[model samples]
Target: MTTHTPTTPEQLLEKLTALGIEATTINHPAVYTVEESKAHRGDLPGAHTKNLFLRNKKGKMWLLVCLEDRKIDIKLLGKALEAGKLSFGSAARLMEFLGIEPGSVSPFSAINDREGQVKVVLDTQMMTQSPINAHPLTNTMTTAITPTDLVRFLESIDHAPEELDMNNLAELATKAE
Candidate 1:
C-alpha cells in the first residue's frame, strides 16, 4: 500500500502562524456533523462554519464555506456557482487536493493546496463575523480566526476564495427551478 503523509493539526497551526494569522484552537471529541460539533463547541465565539468539497462536471473543484446553519442544496448551489452540476468530491480527492479527510475539510486545508486546484467559496454572511471557526486539519479540534485572516491565509496559499451571498444563492436556485 502506498503511504501518504497527512498534514497534521500542529503543522497547519505553524503555517498559520508563519502567515501572521492569529488563531485559537480547541480540542474536543471527534465530531462529523454540525449538530455534533455544536455539542462540543460550547460558548465559542464566532460563526461556526461548514465546508463542502465539490467537483463539477468539467472537473473543476470547489471548496465552499458557509455558516453551520445555512441550508444548501447542491443542485442549486451548482447553478449559483455556474459550475454545471456538482457532486461531493471523493475522500481520496479530498486528501489528494486538500490533504485532509472527510470530517476534517476546512478552509485551513487551503494551506496544503499549493497548486490552487480547488476554488474556495465563502458565504458572504459568514464573512461578516469577525471570527470564524473551522477544523484544524482534524475533526477533533476547531480553530478560530478572523474572517480577514482567513482570506489572508487562503491568498497566502494561492487559493483566494470567491464570496457568495447565501441568500442570493437561494434565490438563484429558486429562479432556476
Candidate 2:
C-alpha cells in the first residue's frame, strides 16, 4: 500500500494561485472550535464556516460544510443525503481521507483527497455569503475566498461538491421522529 503525503497550507495556497483563484489569509493563534475562533475572527467579512467529516454505516464518507452557527441534525442529514445512520469520522479516518486533523477540517482540505474518496456537501445558505472563511489545511490561519472561487478551486482538484440548503435540516430531523 502506498502512503500519501498530506498537503500543506503553502501548497494549498500555491494551487489556488495556479488556478487563478484569489484568497486572503490571516494568521492567528490556533483555534480548535467555532467558539474559540470567534475571538480571532472579529469583523472578518463573510460567513465563518464549520466543516464536518462524517461516515455512514456503509463507510461512505462525506464532508459537510455549513455556516458556523447553523444547527445540524445529523440523523436528518443522514436521511436527507441518503447516507444512513451517520457518525463523525474518526481522527485516523480524517487524516487518511482529508489529510487534516479534527480542528483543521475545511472544504479546502479537498485538495488532499487525490482519490476523491470523500464527497463534499456544501450548504446553499452558506454559499450565498459574499466571502467564506475556512482553514487552509490548519487552524492557525483562516482563508477567505469568494464562493465562486471556492467552487473553482474544488473543481480544479476534481472534487465538484453537492450543494444543499441546510436551513431545514433541524425541521427534517423533527419530522423524522
Candidate 3:
C-alpha cells in the first residue's frame, strides 16, 4: 500500500491563497490542547476554535469546529445530530480520514478528505465572529481568516460546511440538567 503525505501548514496556506482567501497566521510553541493554546494567542482579535473528530458506530464521521469556550456534550450532540453513540475518532482514523493527528484536528484539514468522508460543522456563534482562528493542519500555528473566507476555502475543497448554533445547543443541554 502506498503511504499518503499529510498536508503541511504551508501547503494549506497556499491552498487558501489559491482560493483568494486572505488569512493571517501566527506561529507559537506547539499546543496540544485548547487550554495550552490560550497562553499563546496574545491579543489576537477573533474567535479561536476547538475542533473534534468524531465517529458514530456506523462509521459516519464529523469534523466539528466550534468556539474554543463552547462546552460540548457528546451524548446530547449525538441525539441532536441523530448520530447515535458518537465517540472521538481514533488518532489513526483521524489521519486516515483527514490526514491529521489528534491535537491538530482542523476543519481546514478537509482538503485532505478528497473523498468527502467527513461532514464538516462550523459553530454558528463562532462563525459570526470575525477572523476565525484555527490550526492550519498543525498545532504550532494559528491561521486567522474572515468567516466568509473560511467557508469559501472549505467550499473550494468541496467540503462545504454546515453552520449550526452550538451555543444554543449547549444552552438547551444546560436547561435539561
Candidate 4:
C-alpha cells in the first residue's frame, strides 16, 4: 500500500477548492498557546477560533470550537452537553483519531476523522460569522474561510457538529493566563 502524507493546511485548501469552497490561509510560527494566536490576528481578518479536543469518561472523542477567551468548565460542560464527563484527549488518540498533535487541535483536522468517529461541537455564537479563522491541521498555520464553507466541509467529512451553549469558556481563558 502506498502511504500518503497526512492532511496539511494546504492540502485542506485544495480539498476545499474541489468542493467549491473558496478559502485562504496564513502561515505563522508554530503557536502552542491561544495568546500567541492573537499576535497573528491583527494581520488576518475574520473570526478567530479556539479548538479543544476532548474525550468523555468512556473515551468517546469530541472536537469543541469557540471564540478565543471563552471559559469552559469540564464538569458543567459534561452536564450541559450531556457528554458524560469530558477531558482532553491523549496525544496518542489525537494522532490516531484526528491525525493531529497536542497544542495543534483544530476543526480542520476533522478531515482526518475518516471514520466519522469523533463528534464536532461548536459554540452557537461562532455560526454567526461569515468567515472564520482556525488552524488548518496544525497550530503553526491559520486558515480563513466562510462559515458556509466550513459547514460544507464538515458535512462532506461527516462531522457536522452539534451546537451547544453549554460551556462558558471565557472564564476558562482568564484563569489559564
- Which predicted model would earn the best TM-score? 2
Error of 1 at 109 (Å): 1.0
Worst 10 residues of 1 by lDDT: 1-10
Tell me the TM-score of model 3: 0.92
Question: Mind giving the per-residue lDDT tens digits that candidate 2 earns over 1-177?
Answer: 246899999999998899888899999999999999998888889989999999988889999999999888888899788777999999999998888988999999998888888999999999999799999999999999999999989888899999977987766555655
Candidates sorted by TM-score, best first: 2, 3, 1, 4
- Candidate 1: segments with Cα more than 4 A from true spot: 1-4, 170-177
Ranking by lDDT: 2, 1, 3, 4
- The pairs that clash in candidate 2 are none
Model 1: per-residue Cα lDDT over 53-112, one tens digit each: 999888899999999999888888998888889999999988888889899999988777
How high is the lDDT of residue 65 in model 2? 95
Highest lDDT model number = 2
Q: List the residue pairs that clash in candidate 3.
A: none
Cα displacement (Å) at residue 34, model 4: 1.0
Q: Rate the local accuracy (lDDT) of all candidates.
A: 0.89, 0.91, 0.87, 0.79
For model 4, how does the per-residue alpha-carbon lDDT over 37-103 read when each residue is reduced to its tens digit?
Answer: 8876566766788888888878778898887777777776665656667898889888888888887
Per-candidate TM vs. native? 0.92, 0.94, 0.92, 0.87
Clashing pairs in 1: none
